[model samples]
Target chain A: MNDIVLNVSNIGKHFGGLQALENVNLQIEAGKTHAIIGPNGAGKSTLLNVCVGRIKPDTGSVKFLGDNLTGRKPHEINQLGVARVFQTPEIFPELTLLRNVMVPAFAKREGAFKLNAFRKVDNEAEVRDEAEHILEDVGLKEQMNGLAGSLSRGDKRRLELAMCLIQHPKLLLLDEPTAGMSRHDTNRTIDLLRLIKERGMTKVIIEHDMHVVFSLADHISVLAQGQIIVEGSPDMVRGNARVQEAYLGGAHV
Target chain B: MAQLWHRNDLLLMGVFTLAVLAMPLWLAPFGAGYPDLLQKLAIYGIFAIGFNILFGLTGYLSFGHAAFLGVGSYAAVWSFKLFTMNVLPAVLFGTLLAGVFAALIGFISLRRSGIYFSILTLAFAQMSYNLAYSVLTPITNGETGLQLTQSDPRIIDRLYVEATSGLPSTELFGLKMSGYPGFYFCAAILIIAFFFSVRIFNSPFGVKLLAIKSNQTRMGYTGYNTRPYLLVAFVISGMYAGLAGSLLAVTDPLAGAERMQWTASGEVVLMTILGGAGTLIGPLLGAGLIKYFENVFSAYNEAVLHQIFAMLPDWLQSAMVFVVNPFVGEGWHLTLGALFVLIVIFLPGGIMEGIRRLSSLVRRIIARSRRDGLQAA
Candidate 1:
């Protein structure tokens, strides 16, 4: 569909004798937060990895905005407006928070890679202003000069979110963003995700936290044993008998 | 104000330049012998600085930087022999050729990072050495080495004298030195190279290089194609090595395949690490220390040792000679190896780190003294 930002069809990934992921199908629209919830070792990360072109599926197709993303390199996939945040906050640790955000801004502004050596970065006033705005959005304006490595965990995740969002990607894939956050920080993250969605960006969050999934997910897909057990609206998935049996520890629905 | 100065990479560079220029004067008590050592130190300093940019900042340890340096020297020598005898063309050609060589190597080496990158560069450098030694005999002049002929047909030399009278004993702009002008010329070029390095280090590109080193995978996911950034950095560093190579030929005007050898590449790595891998001034300090051992340590002979040892009893002197023997005598490599091990074990940050720590201590003392003075006032 024209509004579909990402479409994964019958994707499967296998590593020798072990199956990492099995027949999975997912569809994300242009401006929605789609959460994939699964228990430990449920292939939520592998699915996200496949979406971001970090790993190739043994069989299947990943389509983003009508283009096949299956064989493309991660950077190439990113250039096509798919930004991913790692399970761990992956940022240039030694660089300042401002510079970390600037990396994506540079890529987006100067298509692919550029050798813009002689031009001063400050001379590009627009990009710098936009980067500052991004930092402001992520609540890191005060710590712009602070090294990325020195930031607290929540701030690092926020900084990374800013980095991905600054690129203005059509789709953002987040892997366990609130995995290690405290309840306060997790709620703060849910609020951030709400703000991003409210601003009209599509996101796919692979989260183990059921509260986060139930609260933030517009559409929830429950994964089990490397395959999609069920996908429906958050309340429907939360109420599904099979989802309860497979993922919700067979709890009463 | 002091904090601002320290934060400003350019200001630090200017201070470094002033210190480097004034180095010979500070060691003037050691006289002409020391200036030559200082010159060698500065030359290798530039070499190590370039190598450090590629390896230290980018974390792409290259075991083949000598190939670029050696080729750069060859380019400079060729420029001197065929075109202008002036150092400018030679240095330019040398550095540009190094960049070109780096582009080719980087294209392939960038395909694989980590250990594979190191092995690829090493293999390529070895290939360059072999080509220089044998197949490229016409250009590199084979085993005998590429040097300037007394009957060189260069236009810059022709402009100074009648074309009929020929090369005019290789005087630089009519100020004849027993090659002292050549040495000074090299020093000036090194100064320029150092300045260039400072500009680059402070640039956005330099920051990106550091980022690439930190997490290339993250960079890639962040919509950055890190390969191009890495390639550009590789080329820039290669050009710096080229400039150093050109300066080497300007001082002595001889380029040999030995300069491209794996051991030579290994030396630059040692220099950079010994000085301080990531810090700006570390490579220069490391290069200076290693080159000092190569030149000054090798200069000490049995007669000089005897002259110093004569004050002691004959038996005791013999024992002293034996004790001081390996480091002072023919075992200069042993001294270098020992120095390397000592630096690695104790001062891994190299001489630059040692200096930084010393300066910090001084600063702390100054701050305490100021506090005391303020209370008294």
Candidate 2:
């Protein structure tokens, strides 16, 4: 078996009376894509949030590369080689695409924070080149000088992905990499993921599209009402009776 | 060598140095070449530049920065009284004390952001002002202010020479810190402060601050602890205010409770906004313009206005005076307010943005004319 990059066990979260997540356990292996597929309220996002340290899970613990990630800050987790792509791209709208990617590079190079107030930002030519290379990899070299906010929804997603990939994260958590894209854009995103996967990077993708899930995921976990009903390979998850009754019955997937 | 000179920061520093050094010559035309107003310009320029490091870059509008200025003034005055009449010690002590005060206020105020942060600073400033006026009277000398006296022990100066004057004015070594010398000293400090600001604006630390301004949540997720950055900026700005305050004492040798007033804080905000907050040169321009209006424009009364309009017809002169009456003299603030409103409405980016727009428009016109000339040829 491949080494587990992330081990989230018995995680439970509550928002007042509502149970956002209940007894969730996920083991994301190294060099593989794990897709968490569910209905609208299946708590996929909540789990992703917990894993990234956005929300504190009430019970259980998250261990990434033998370090306890529970109750840590989002930035702390990010510094520990866990980069996240949000549901909607959260980029510096006023800054250029190159700068949008450079911020993460600076963070990765300078640790969480540093006081390099006297040195010129442009003097760090290596980081700038790395940012440019990543922007080129994501096919945003043409728009690298343009404002991140001016990009189309598809381009914004691509820019955000470039930001994460530049960090060279050991584990990437993507919350719907192609949520509001057309079929063409979605196919392009799938190809991007395939390219990333070829480099042996671990990814935990929370996606709604069954086509994306089946195409990208090496292993699939079917979550329904904040609990995973079945977890296995794509064929096993497709053949699971409980998953069919709970989620896939209504959808044509 | 050309590349070194061509760098943005070096070029800015060179321009600023030339302007400040030649202040006496250029400002003579504006009738503001006198030492007092020139020193005021430099001091307030430092204050606004410091304030911009936080407010302009991070978008943290501090409403209580005057507290630091007041603290700095008081500290400098005390330094004069106890230690020596040297301007250096006074300035140093004042800046350090203001930094400490800023750290204290910033630590508590930064917990809450946006308007809440602003209100917290305002409250703290008001508290400082009231305390300086009342309960802290023993230290602050109440409304009368802290002033140097003849009887005060001059431990450092006494080592060099006997008491020659009744009241020793502030000095740097043997050189008196009044008149042109004082203005030059303040100008030198202002240039240094401007250079530091330019460096901070171009540094990675500056980019982090801008990122924090753009999206704090994204910065946090990007693994940056933004609170420390904010606090550092706050303290640095406060130190700048303190330095300005120290210069005020160095030139005048008095620390007053009124220096800590909210209106004084508001003036710096006006300076930053009027000149263009984020740009390096904006705050200095704002400070000079406001000071010029306050000092020179307010001195223009009905006699001066009538004299200027003497060439015009009698009816036109009276009409002009009537129209301009509310904007000059005692009504100078009315003019400032109107200008502020107009800038906000038409040029939201402030004077720097106005300059940028005008320059771009000129460039466009020039480019079109060149194309037309080429076609004719």
Candidate 3:
């Protein structure tokens, strides 16, 4: 069995009376893609946010490589080789695509803070080349000089993925990587994930698209109303009765 | 081989040196060659440039920067009273003190951003102004301001050498800080400050600042501790204002409570926005233009306006003066307000953006003409 890269135990979060996440326990193994599939308002985003330190859970602990990640700032968690791709592609809009990628590259390379005022950013040839390489890998090399804000929605999503990928995180957390894309774009994204999977990077993807879930997930967890109904392989998840009643049944009805 | 002067640092230094060295010759045409106006230009230019680092780059608009300037002035004046009349110690003390003060204010104020941040700074500045005017009268001398007196012990000058003058003037190794020499001294320091600003603009630190401006939430998630970065910027800018304040005292030798007023802070903000906040040369141009109008244009009364149009018929000249009356002399502020409105309406990017648009338009016209000529041939 592969070593577990991320482990979450007794994670529970509440907003007033609504339970966002309740008694959530998850263990993601290294070099595997785990997909969390749930209906609308099913606490997928809340779980992801908790894992990435965006929100503090009411009770629980998140451990990555034996280090506790509870109550840490988002940036502090990011420094520990856990990169997150936002649902809407949170990127530096005014900056060029090359610079958008380079910001994370600088953060990953230089740690949290460095007073490099006198030194020119362009002088860091290695960082620039690495940024360029990532852009090329993501097929955004031609538009590297273009402003990130001006890119189409599909390209913006791709650029954001490239930014997270450049950090070479031990574990990547993608929150609805293809949230608002056409079928063509979704297919492209699925292909991209398959390509990323070959590199042996562990990823936890929170997606609602069943096609994407079945295509990429080595292990699928079907969540509904703040709790996972079933955890199994894609074939097993497709055949589970509780998951059908809670998720697939509701979708059809 | 690449030319040594082609490097950005060297080029910037060369241009700044040329501008400062030629200030006397060029400024003479505007009747502003006198040391007083020239010194004010350099001092305010430093103030605006420092303000730009925080407001322009980081989008953290500070409304209390003048408080630092006032603090700096007080520190310099105290330095003069306790130490020698040399400007070095005064400048150092002013800058360091302002930095400390800025760190304290910035630590608390940066907790909130946008208008809340601005209000916090404004409140702190008002409190300081009030304290300086009333409760801190012993240190600040109240409304009278702090000035050097003969009775004050100049321990350094007295211990080292004999006193020759009735009242000592601010100096650098016996070079008096007055007239053309004083202007040159301030101009030299302004050049150094400008160079540092340019370096910061091109650095990785600058990119991070722009990122903070873009999205603070995303910046935090990207593994950047933005608070320290912001605080450092705030302190650096405050030090710049302090440096400017020290220069003001170095030349004139007075530290007044009124200097810390909100209007003084507003003036720097005006200078930055009027010129182009983020651009390198914008703040300097804004400072120079505002000072020029305040000093020169305000001096043009109705008599001077009438004299300029003396060749025209009596009725025509009176008509011209009547039309121009509200824009000059005591009404110069009206002209400034009108210009600001026009710029905001048409060129929201300020004077620098206007220049960019004009140049691009010119380029387009030239390119089209060239294309037509080629087609005709």
DockQ ranking from best candidate downward: 2, 3, 1
Better of 2 and 3 by TM-score: 2
* Candidate 2 chain B least-lDDT 10 residues: B1-10
Off by over 4 Å in 3: A249-253, B1-6
DockQ of each: 0.51, 0.66, 0.63
Ranking 1 against 2 by TM-score, winner: 2
Put down candidate 1 lDDT per residue, B1-377, tens digits, no spaces. Answer: 43454467566666776776677676566443454566677778888878877887789999899999998999989888887666777778999999999999999998999999999999999999999989999999999999888666786666665555334333355554234455565566677777766656655667667788888888878767788888887888888889889877876788999999999999999989888987777888788777777766787887778779999999998888787778865788899899889878988778877888899999999999999999999
Choose the strongest candidate by TM-score. 2
Worst 10 residues of 1 chain A by lDDT: A116-125
The number of clashing residue pairs in model 2 is 0
What is the per-residue lDDT of model 2 for residues B230-347, given as tens digits with 9 covering 90 to 100? Answer: 9999999999999999989999989999999999999999999999988888988998899988998799899999999999999999999999887899999998998999998999
User: What is the lDDT of every predicted structure here?
Assistant: 0.82, 0.91, 0.90
Residue runs of model 2 more than 4 Å from their true location after superposition = A249-252, B1-6
Look at candidate 3 and tell me the lDDT of residue A226: 91
- Top candidate when judged by DockQ against the true structure: 2
TM-score of 1: 0.90
